[model samples]
Target chain A: MIKVSILGTGNVATHLFKAFSKSDEIEIIQVIGRNKKALLAFAPENKTTSDFSDLKESDVYIIALSDNYIKTVSEQLTIENKLIVHTSGSTPMNELSHHQRHGVFYPLQTFSKSNELDFKKVPICLEAKSKEDLALLKNLANLVSENVYEIHTEQRKSLHLAAVFVNNFTNHLYHLGSEICEENNVPFQILSPLIQETARKIETLSPYEAQTGPARRNDSNTITNQLEQIKKPELKAVYELLSKSIQATYGKEL
Target chain B: MIKVSILGTGNVATHLFKAFSKSDEIEIIQVIGRNKKALLAFAPENKTTSDFSDLKESDVYIIALSDNYIKTVSEQLTIENKLIVHTSGSTPMNELSHHQRHGVFYPLQTFSKSNELDFKKVPICLEAKSKEDLALLKNLANLVSENVYEIHTEQRKSLHLAAVFVNNFTNHLYHLGSEICEENNVPFQILSPLIQETARKIETLSPYEAQTGPARRNDSNTITNQLEQIKKPELKAVYELLSKSIQATYGKEL
Candidate 1:
């Protein structure tokens, strides 16, 4: 079995640790973190360490730390001429180019401390410096997930950008909706289904094809009325910008 | 059981027809459409002609048509004292103020023909001109859903605006992501988990609370690199706008 050392103790680390531990393909050789307190009493018998310098015996080294700290942690590690990978979608795999064999094994799913994730369907994005590293990354990804996609570092950057729009920006909109509800003394829960449905539709239909509403129709009256109704200046600004974009996309004016 | 007639055989109508049929809440009195073929397949006992003049009998009239059409269709109905409601989150209930006793029983869920909606969980937003109408709408919504919320027209409009951001605009971002992948000969499926996870996170955490990425961190190098990496003009524009918004949200600078 391939031996693996996982670094970091946050959401990404915890998620990968639990998922990999359940998998038969990889053995957890060590769980490394700077904080000894984070070295849980329940950690595996095979290995665990508080220092990255202590990790010398492993087939693969997986860095699950934040982007800012990855460079420092990678230098502290002892392993060389072996596969070293990070689990980040935005950070370039080449960020670990200091290592002879570097790659990325980014599970695209959101990780929360309390929530259990479905690894079987979750897409694992793999990127590596060379063909041999790619093969190793793919093999590890394939073991845990049915959806394994090989992405270039440059492409991953674009994908990451798109994800911010889809995820981060989208959630911001949900916040706007909730805020609107709060201002009006209405429960934001009312919009939850609509929010869910919008996402659900994108699974089967293209967003361009699925486009609807006053903005798409260029209903000026409704648009004006809506602008009048929205009290928050920031939300109103967002509404106007999005409405403009929608109009631009459709060749229809708002 | 309450008897209901559905006016309009569009996406909303079709989704509601099947959903209502599955629930033991109400008997569908009739299904009316502009096209004879669309209405022909509906249950004969429950289905009727497209003409509102030929509208036979029902306790409640649910106009599941478009916002542009709701006003026109409401004017078309001959019956006066009917408990009429339209299923639109964006359209104000006062739009039907000309009617004797009008209300909104908007199921604020996004509807797709292929996807089976979990009607029980999706919140049904209720509003009415009269107190009795409010109770009736709430009862009607409660039969099919556990989450019933009373939202005003102003808040619902804002919610609709927010929805356009999260659902429609977000999905558009997905399209952009997929398009960039297709152009670069990379599989778009790589971003699917990220997309799903992005939506899943909001179930527990606030959007602002869950925010993470280059934009939030003010990582200009990565932002510049991503902007240069993207080939499409629209995507570049979206990325720039969203990054600015995120920077603004996080009290960061470009």
Candidate 2:
């Protein structure tokens, strides 16, 4: 069985801990976090510690920390000759380069404390310095998820950026929709099915082909009406800019 | 049985036709369209006509045409004192006021010819000029969909505007993500789980509570890194503006 220790007590770390706990091929050696209170969630069944220097012996140490804390926390790990990986999309694998073996084990999904995620479907992006390390990471990743890819630092960087657009920015648009619904005394649930269908469409059709609306059609009359309806300046600007972008993207296709 | 005639042969019209076909309580007497070729899909199973004057007798007429064409199409119908409703989000119910009996039967979801939708889950927003007309439209809406709302013109205008943000604009964001994935040689499917999770999160949490990422956290380091990674001027602008909007939104909360 592959022995693993997870660092950080954030959503990603907690999720990885839970996912590894389910796999027969993996063993949770320890969970390290600076926040003693935050570590309580993982302390019950496994060894948990706030001291980074006194980490347990594990085959792989997964640092599931924030982007800024990744390098700092990796530097604190006094362990030697063991594989060290950070679960970050934007941060390169070399962020753990202080160690002899470094890699990236980023899960390309948003994690929520309240939600139960099926890790099997979550795509795990792996990167390592050596082929042996890569294979080891892949083996551990396969235990928890079926979708695994050996994405290098450059590709992972692009993936992270792309994710920000699709996940972070898309959620923001949902927020804007909710705000508009609230102002009009309409329940935000009215748009739930639409949101689900929008995501589902990309499964069968390319986002380019799946696209439809006033912007895609360049229906100037509806566009103008929508613009007039949006009272907030920021929302209006976003509406104008995105509408223009959609028109430009499809305009090129024709 | 509630007799209904569907006007136009667009995505909405065809989807409604398919939905009504499954319901035993709703009889689709005729499918009307100006384009003979487009009407062929429905011609095999039901009466299809191109001539506007040669319309069949039905309890209700559904004008599922483009926003601009709704009025013109309704005006062409010589039948009087019939429930003539338009399936449009932005077009006000009064757009069909020329008819003695006018209403709105808008489905609040994006319709695609390629996708098979569960009509029961689709939210059908109904509005009418009179109580009797409203009851008639609600009855027809209930025949196909389980989720029905009595949304007036002003409320529907906002709902449509909100939908543009959540559905249309959100799909555009997906397109942008796909472009980034292509450029980096990363399969767009990697982000699919993330996209789905983002949408699913709103079911349990409000969009404000569900929001996460660099902009939500105001992580300047990651935000700056992402901005630098985006090469195109237009995409860069979108990233910046959206990031700013997200920050502005959360900033007020603090």
Candidate 3:
């Protein structure tokens, strides 16, 4: 069994601990965190410690802390020559440079404490310094998830950026759409199927081939009507900017 | 049984044909389109007509043509006093004013020819000139979908605008994400679970509450890094604008 120590109490760490605990091939060696209250949530099943010096030896130490603390926390680790990694999308794998063997185990999915995610469907992007480390990381990731990729820092950065667009920006649009629905006395539930279908379409058609709307069609009448209907300045600005972007993407004029 | 005729042979029209054809309550009397090749695809099962004059009488006629052609096609419909409706999210119901009984039967979901949508899950927004017409439209809509809302012209307009943001603009973001993945030599499939989860989140959490990323957290360091990493001019502009918008949304400084 691969012994693992998860070094955080946040959503990603909690999730990783739970997932690892369920696996027959993995053993939870310890759960370490700064906050005792947070650490208590996972302490019942495994050894829990707040002191950096109390960390135990494990096959892999996953520093699932926030990006700002990743470097500082890695530098304070007592373990040596073990596979050390961080579960960050944007942070470079080098953040754990203090270790002789380090890698990344970034799960490319948003996590919430309340929402239980199926690790099997979540893609685990791995980056390591050596082929042996890479193979080991792949083995651990494969135990939990079907998708495992060898993503270097640059590629991981690109994925993170793209994620900001697809997840963050798209969620913002949903927020705006919800606002529009509320203002019109319409239930936001009406838009759920549309939202789900939009994501599902990319499974078959590329966004370029799948794009359809007033802006893509250059239907100025509908476009102008939409602009006039939007009251909020921020929302209007977003609608106008995205519309223009869609038009430009399609090689269409304003 | 509700006798209905569908105009246009686009994605919406084709999907509507298949949906109505399956329903025992609805009888598709005729399918009309200008393109013979497209019409041929639907000819084997139904009475297909290329000429507008050949349009037969039905209890309700659905104009599933593009937004630009809604008015032109509705004007050519020789049927009078019959309920004539257009399946467009953006087009105002008055676009079919030429007909005495006119309404909107907008199925508020992205329709693709290859994707067979469960109409029961698709929200069909209805609007009409009168209560009787609205009821008739609702009845026909209920035959196919569980979600049937009496959306007026203004509210439908708002919904349409929101749909643009959530569907068209969101799909564009997915396309951009795929492009980024391709450029980085990362399999785009790695991002699919992330995309699906983002959409699934708003089912329980509002988009405002669900929003997460550099901009939401006001992580200037990561935001700046992302801006620098994006090389494409259009992608960069979108990233910057969206970041500013997101910051503004959370009442944070750029």
Off by over 4 Å in 2: none
Model 2: per-residue Cα lDDT over B69-154, one tens digit each: 98888887899889999999988999898898999999998888879989899999999999999999888898899999999899
Determine the iRMS, in angstroms, of model 1: 2.3
Number of the top DockQ candidate = 2
Better structure of 2 and 3 per TM-score? 2
Poorest 10 consecutive residues by lDDT, candidate 3 chain B: B245-254
Model 2 CA lDDT for position B119:
88
Q: Model 2 — TM-score against the truth? A: 0.98
Order of candidates by DockQ, top first? Answer: 2, 3, 1
* A239: Cα error in model 3, Å: 1.9
Q: For candidate 3, write residues B1-254 as lDDT tens digits.
A: 99999898999998888888889999889998889889988956459988898878799988998888989878877777789999887777888888888999999998878887788898988988989989898889898889888888888888887788899989988888888989988888788898999999999999989989998998999988988898889888888888888888888444
Q: List TM-score per model, in order.
A: 0.89, 0.98, 0.96
lDDT of residue A244 for candidate 1 = 71
Candidate 2: which pairs clash? none
How does the DockQ of candidate 3 come out? 0.83
